[model samples]
Target: MSDSHPKVLLTGATGFVGGRLLPALLEAGLSTRCLVRSAERFRKPGTGGPGFETVEGDLLDPGSLARALEGMDAAFYLVHSMGGRSISRYRDYIDRDIRAAENFVRAADAAGVKRIIYLGGLGETGDNLSDHLSSRQMVGEILQSGRVQTTALRAANIIGAGGAPFEMLRYLVERIPLMVCPRWIDTKCQPIAIQNVIEYLLGCLLQPAAAGLTLDIGGPDIITYRDLMLIYARARGLKRVIVTVPVLTPKLSSYWINLITPVPAGVVMPLVEGLKNEVICKDNRILDLVPIRLIPMEEAVCMALAEISEGPGRIPSMQSCLIRDV
Candidate 1:
């Protein structure tokens, strides 16, 4: 609202999206503070450069949240409880996420935080949604219902190195020559690049018109899980045969993914459950408000591969990958 840059407080600074978003936020010249569980864990000697600092806190603690949000112009609600390594503990993720969001809403509202930006899943809201996707949407609702202005950016599977969806796809195609898939393989989803997601999040903060709105963000291509598998296969110069089986439920599919990928079953199960439902963007208003060059699936997969690859095996880009043809 003023000529001076707003002070921003970022939660989940050590998370998948937050980890990446932190650098982008600092580089864009905002005075940034990270609300991390441990300052020592999220900070380094020169990590975030100028106008960056860290505050130790937890979302579940209202006092800590108050301390973190005080004097901050904007904050990001990026915390999610689904990434734990213990499979047995995943059952509590939904409840914990709900509580955390409630705390954040109250704390932010009381502290007079000007705006909040939440990154949520891109699934249709209804009674039949998976627990993971529903929890994400519920958190958005919790934040939006508060007195503080909130911008919710919903996106489907984000393609990037070390991300759950990308890791599952990468390891699956790299290891499995013949995959026994379920009916959800054909489910439609609009995937977005991690970089694109970062840009949209940054754009929302700068564009005040984005306040108190829910926006769908996705890449240029909308494809099925089967199409993504095929694209990953092509990118790596490998041949894969996927045979669909109607009876292989989400549990079975998650088990299969757990055995194949480095990602834990705790994380894969909820994501696998979400695959049964279509997750394409409902609208593209964000494209007009925060215009960005969307990265297609082909290029996104290649970019992910390049990140995890070593010196001799890197696929520089989609067009330059020698095996992208077949």
Candidate 2:
């Protein structure tokens, strides 16, 4: 690593995507710092060594965010309140998200952070947008409205081991020979592998084309939720049948998922409801900018499964996977 690398701050360093992203940033030779609510939770042995630091901070606490953003060239915003205490209703989550995003925007602006890179949910803006997806988009908009340049990457159904959505799909396919799915299963999505997602994030760091851009990122495959489950079954060499019924409401579907998979209803509801809207990528601008060999749906499934069986905290091999112009 060079001595003059850009200093970067990463929020949500303990979360699934952020956890993976922390190391990827380090591997890319950036001087990385993580803003975590609790330092102990993130400071495990053999991690955050030279060129990395962990700062105790909270997005809701502007003072902490200001301190964390000090002298940082860029920051990755990956924080969300999906299953917090005030989340009885979906709007509650939205309100909390808005509050946190506003605080981040103000603090980052005050500290003169150069750019804000955010990962938000994928969905078209419309009346039918679920509260979950709407909130995610709204956060991106709030970050973009700030003084700093913002690169918002909207993604759908990120396929990875131990990810909430992938775990839901994996457990459902593994445990059930036949599935009773809601109409949302037929809704189309472009699922990306976790490896590809990290690649895009790393590529955006110094890529001028990604600045001030709201890009949609995903794998090469456009698949439905039903197709995703079936693909997992095929990849795992399991036979399964999916029966899509229109009568199941999002509430009912969440409960169904809760009963079948280890994912709780609280976490499952928003994801299930969001599925009612198709989340396939409409823009391929990221392909031209990042230029990664997009993984296929089945191959992503296999990679995710391999990670799951191999245990946690391991990213797929990157020896031949990465090709960056920077």
Candidate 3:
């Protein structure tokens, strides 16, 4: 690594995507700093390693975020609120997501940071977007408002150990032999693997083309939620059946998911509602810029399973999967 290598500030370092991203950023030889809520969390097994500097901070608090943003060349915004009980009542969700982005942007500007990289969801803009996707888009806008260059990577269902989509698929396939699928099940989605997402994030750090841009990243295969379940079933060596019923609204589907999977009604509702919209990437601009060979869905699923069998904390698994589903 050159002396000119950027010192990167990473938020959400304890979360699923951030946890996976930490190792990748370290391996890439970048000078890395992580913003964590509690320093004690960093002492846990599989949390820290060489090349990481952990600082305590809270996104909800601008002062803390400003302190964390000091002396960094760039920052990654990877936080989201899905575990909350009621998505509708989460004023803090919007406030924290938007305000945190804004504060980070302002702090980065004050610190003379060069760029901001954010990971958001993939969905068509307009009224069709779910609350989660809408908030994610808002975060991107907030970050871009600052003078610093911002790169936003929008992805559809990310398939990996510790990702929400993978955990949902795992639970649904493992728990329910016969799934009563909703209309969203047939909706098309481009699911990217965790490895590919990490690749894209790393690529952004070096690719000038990624600056001040929003890029869509997806896997090589464009498949449906139904297709995802089938692939998982085949991978797990379990024969399962899906019965698509037309009358099941997103609300009812969420209830069903809550019953069958480890995902709560709050998380499942937005995720299910979002599935109603097809999430396939509309452009290949990212390919021209990052030029990564996307992994196939089957291979991604196999890798996730392999990680799961190896043991806990090696891979990020949903709390629900470990406690309720598995």
Candidate 4:
């Protein structure tokens, strides 16, 4: 590894956001190493590249985490298992995340890693948050408790292909002509583009002010979940009618989501519950700090649909508006 670029240890390299971030980090001249449960996960076609290495490790295994964190400058903690079939119970997933964070923090501190960059969920702290959002915030707090400087970027629904949120909206609008939405669909949120998210994650690494900070990263538009489905429908050239019904419980909504969308019941339940709370960003300090143009909801939806049509490409470097963080 070269001494010029930071040696970054990236977890969740095989997951949606991490998979996109992996190449972006490398393109930004960072010396990258990924921590995966199995090294073979990176050996598939279009998954390998030069100037990056993979280490076999699991966040639950202290020994493996220690080995993985050795001689790393910073670590990107992007692991979450909300949608996994192995999560028998939602509460069990929360416990797993906390345990993993504890193990990772201990190992990172022992290895003398400088910082930890985390992507967490967005929602006001005392809003009777759902188990899924609560677990996300808890993991961020656990990461901050460690000796290393931690930067946790809390973001709302990310509009990107292959993401759970995007897939859910995509399937619902594409399959159903007239849909019955729950009351939670009216909850307000600031959905961001996946491209902008990568920019923020990369920006945090390059900005000294980002250390030991918890920032809200969101797109320009503030809209409800209902608006999101409508925007996605318009972008895909589909005409869909949505009617809100207050009688549907989270359990029933989850079953309906499973029947309509490819997302399973286990994943659908937590997500549907999370939609009950408003997740709009309360702060906009990231705009002044990072200086990238915020993509609007409609434009973001169109871009996401375009990505799905053209297939994935290397995420281009976002032109920075400010040369240095003030």
Q: How accurate is candidate 1 locally (lDDT)?
A: 0.83
Model 4, residue 171: C-alpha shift (Å)? 0.4
In model 1, the clashing pairs are none
lDDT of candidate 2 over 61-156, digit per residue (tens): 887887899999889998887762222564466788899999999998998887889999899998499989999999999999999999999999
Model 4: lDDT of residue 309: 65
lDDT of 3 at 106: 78
RMSD of each: 4.7, 5.7, 2.5, 6.5
- Which runs of model 1 end up more than 4 angstroms from their true locations? 43-47, 310-326
Give the per-residue Cα lDDT of candidate 3 at 95: 60
lDDT digits (tens) for residues 1-326 of candidate 3: 12347889988777767777887887777778988888785633253466568889887677887778788888888887666666465334656677777777877888888888999988887847877788888888888888999998899988877666777789888988988877888999999998999899988888877899988899999998899999999999999999998998987777667776655555666677688877878777999999888899999999989888776656642231443327
Superposed by TM-score, candidate 2 places the C-alpha of residue 324 at a distance from the truth, in angstroms, of 35
Residue 176 deviation, candidate 3, in Å? 0.9
lDDT of 4: 0.81
TM-score of each: 0.92, 0.92, 0.92, 0.91
TM-score of 1: 0.92
The regions of model 3 sitting more than 4 angstroms off are 1-4, 43-50, 86-92, 316-325
**Clashing pairs in model 3?**
162-316
RMSD of 4: 6.5
Model 4, 159-273: lDDT tens per residue? Answer: 8776778777877888889988779888999999998999999888888788889999999999988888888888878888999898988778877777776665556778888
